[model samples]
Target: MTYSSGSLINQKKWILLFHFIIGAIIGVLLLHPLTTMVFWYEYKGLIEFPGNSPIEFLIQRLITEFKFELMPMSFVFALLGGIVGLLFGLYHIRLSGQKNLVRSLEHELAEELPLLIARGESEHLEFKSTYRWDVRQQRTNRALESIVIKTIAGFLNREGGTLLIGVEDNGNIIGIDSDFQTLKHKNRDGFERALMDTVKTSLGGNACALLHCRFHDIENKTICRVIVESAVEPVYYHEDSVARLMVRTGNSTRELDAREAHAYLSSRTTKSFSL
Candidate 1:
């Protein structure tokens, strides 16, 4: 639902009003005894003693100086009234604020998802640092590789996902360490080729057709992107044309589950039947 600007303004006003009322009530209650103490001490010659006897003396002084006859039931009722009113007001304000927060988040997500899906944001799609494909840390840090594979695979296995090689999950454009020349020097056709080959070997053709590898440049630095379309068949990576499987989950590539294998086959069979 949409909240008009006027409604939002009124909501803020109500919030402030509630806070003001609670503060006023608390201020009066806390200050009333102090005001009464001064009146009793100054006007009625009532005094409180020092140290351990201070509280006792104050109670005595208050009883003697304050003569307004109030019933225990009335005082109890009044105190309860103030406390309940204050609590209810505070709760309402907090509830309103939470509602606003949730609404704002929903609105933000609606805007962000479109951009993310379109790869519309330059900061998200383009490269930032010089390392396009360094490969210096470890030849095959299978752990890190797993995360990339998982994200890509999850994206592909669901609807589709664009894996930007050089960026973090938060859309910070950190370029991969290796570029085209770097890949060629390292005897790899491209990052996509290596990733695809790996996925194919691991998943055994389940991940192949849906995979698209490409590069984009921002500030003369190249960043790789692997786009995985929804799987019509199970894609697996093979080593030396022998089936050895890997499927990405988050940043880790693991052997496929029976469920995943079945899902791939089911999707392929359904598509073939439709065709």
Candidate 2:
């Protein structure tokens, strides 16, 4: 799970060594012959038109003058070796990154963040530019709180997902600056508290237990990543006089009536109990 610094260093060394050896072999087989030919024909001018055919001339030239430019030719080969090593090293790094992406989703989210933001919207992930920042009105969007709560409740009633606030649907981080302006503390803490208050008020105090909110400053923008865990009990976005049950279907959130919700919950519990 954890790689020591010494092991990582050794891994790098092995990759470099392997690439260097391969490059040296290729340089010897490919570049060496071609370079020797060029030197013999152009610089030396030892092979006259009738003195010898091209093949015989080349073979004899290589046999005789192979040592003349040995140091310079070796330098060229070393340069080629370094280039090959660098290319392969870069490829190895890329493959390592891809493996990490496939192996640990948590690592991807935490470390490979550019790829994480670029992962886009799915059943397990959603993005919102802001909680209450209304671009048109130039103020906080009042309906934003309910919308977020509904999304959270939807996750709770379904397989659960991460809700990234301050990230647009198109995966752009506009930041929570507008929302922060409305808060008293005018920072991440205040914004988080306000969000939790909204969650507790809109859904229930108990729903807060199912959600964990964390703030990240990325690309000079404050992003709120809320991880909503699937609840044992189906969650409902309980507004005044209306407890609307919501669920996640693909990338969109859908609401269910009280009767429909009861039947869905009943069927789910029955299936779970049987399993």
Candidate 3:
């Protein structure tokens, strides 16, 4: 989302040049004729022409005197048009930046999830069997939600990462049907809402903006992929009255105590995260 100074300057120069060219064309083709008509109407009785009809006379004079009389007026109109073009160009650049950000996100999702999963868990990747369902006990475990939130906070506090739910630690696709059954709506929509609610309540609303969730079907089973972006400021996991800073050290989420949290924050520079 950040651009180098040189890149920004280059973009500005190109935008200005493009707009200037367009403005000059409009000035010569449109503004010059409009101005000529206004002047002709104002001095219609005072001026005499060789042609019988007014329209014929105007056209004849335009063809004959264009270079000599209209050059200065065209320059003035072109300058005014250039100023208008610059304003529009600046607004266009701002709008294009936002559009590019959206396209970047779309490109990220368009990438093959299976290929990413094949990489297995790493510093930037983690996998969970379910959101709240306990495969071992064959029941919904509310405690598992806290673990998911903790993992998200860890990624936010660190360099950011992707968390795949409905996948085993070893990368097997189990699907989240078990977790969905526990929800009232029992679908991807319901599941995403629950996940976001948990994140907002435990990790804060701002953290929810840093996470992107999507569902994909792999081998007749649906899996949820949560992409986390590093937070600009430190993020902590809130559990009742306690707040703990969790970080991803390697493949696992680790909690940092007061001194450790301070040291981590001091050593780290803020990063920009966009949805």
Candidate 4:
């Protein structure tokens, strides 16, 4: 007779039965007499039964009738409940770990994006050409008005960088017409005044003095170039967000993240540390 595994599992019910019996024995021995004595003393009339009643008899009858002797069953249920709770806790831990990992990845990506773009642009053929111009063709200098404030704030916060207008990433010339230029746009001297004025208004006086701005001449035409120096201490443009340090990536400017900012300060500020 080949015994089925199912029947063997059924036979294994004794494992549970053994635990129930042991638990019942302990509970009865410890609890039944104590409970009866306490109830008899506390509520004599309420607990009145015929004559001298044996605690064991009442307990045994209660166990038999109500199946309360299945102490092992109660224990098994409690154990299973504990196991389930532990599993849930472990699952929550895993989920929290995953969330932290995702957050770290996002922060790292933000830091690397600008550097990657710059590297790609630098490697391009156009960027390698000898036709580098500071600020060549100025049609409207709309970009000057648009980004001047942001550029200055970034440069002040981190290490300063060049603001090139009308020059393509590959060193190509694209001129901006005078009509498109901002009403305040002027020559080098006048441009400096304008820049200082804006800086003073937005960033306070002496803040602009911490950095410098110079205009570059290209092909006998004038284009504005501004260079700001890193502050003695880290400067914040706004209340919360650190002003993003931006550098030329081909024709575009990309903002540097925290790591790049740290590196910039380290390399530029630590000039005395050269071995």
TM-score of each: 0.37, 0.59, 0.60, 0.34
- Model 1: worst 10 consecutive residues (lDDT sum): 123-132
lDDT of every predicted structure (CA atoms): 0.54, 0.79, 0.86, 0.50
lDDT string, candidate 4, 1-275, tens digits: 44577975664454445544554554455444455456665666676553455565456534543365665554554455445545554565567659967767656744543343344333111121111122446234434442556555555554455454444454553433242244355345555675677667656676777755433344544444444665655554432343545443443444667897688668756863664
- Candidate achieving higher TM-score, 2 or 3: 3
Error of 3 at 9 (Å): 32
Clashes of each: 43, 1, 0, 10
- Backbone clash total for model 4 is 10
TM-score of model 3 relative to the true fold?
A: 0.60
Please report how far candidate 3 places residue 131 from its true position, in Å.
Answer: 0.3
lDDT of 3 by residue, 1-275 (tens): 77899998998889988988787777666666577677677777888655666577657655754486667766787877777777788888889889988877766664678898889999999999999999999998999999999999999988899999999988899999999999998999999999999999998999999999988888888899999999988898999879999999989998998899888877774323222
TM-score of 2: 0.59
**Which stretches of model 1 miss by more than 4 angstroms?**
1-140, 178-188, 234-275
lDDT of 2 by residue, 120-143 (tens): 999988888788888768987779
- The candidate scoring highest on TM-score is 3
Give one digit per residue, the lDDT tens place, for model 1 in 1-275: 77888997897677766655665555445444455456555654345443234355456544543345634433543455566666676787789789988768655743453356345423113212222333556343444554455555555544565566665545555456544445544423456676676566555465677777655554454456565676654444333465433444543335566687777568768878999
What's the CA RMSD for each of the models?
22.1, 18.7, 9.9, 23.9
What shift in Å separates residue 48 of candidate 3 from its native position after superposition?
A: 41
Q: Residue 43 in model 2: shift from native, Å? A: 99
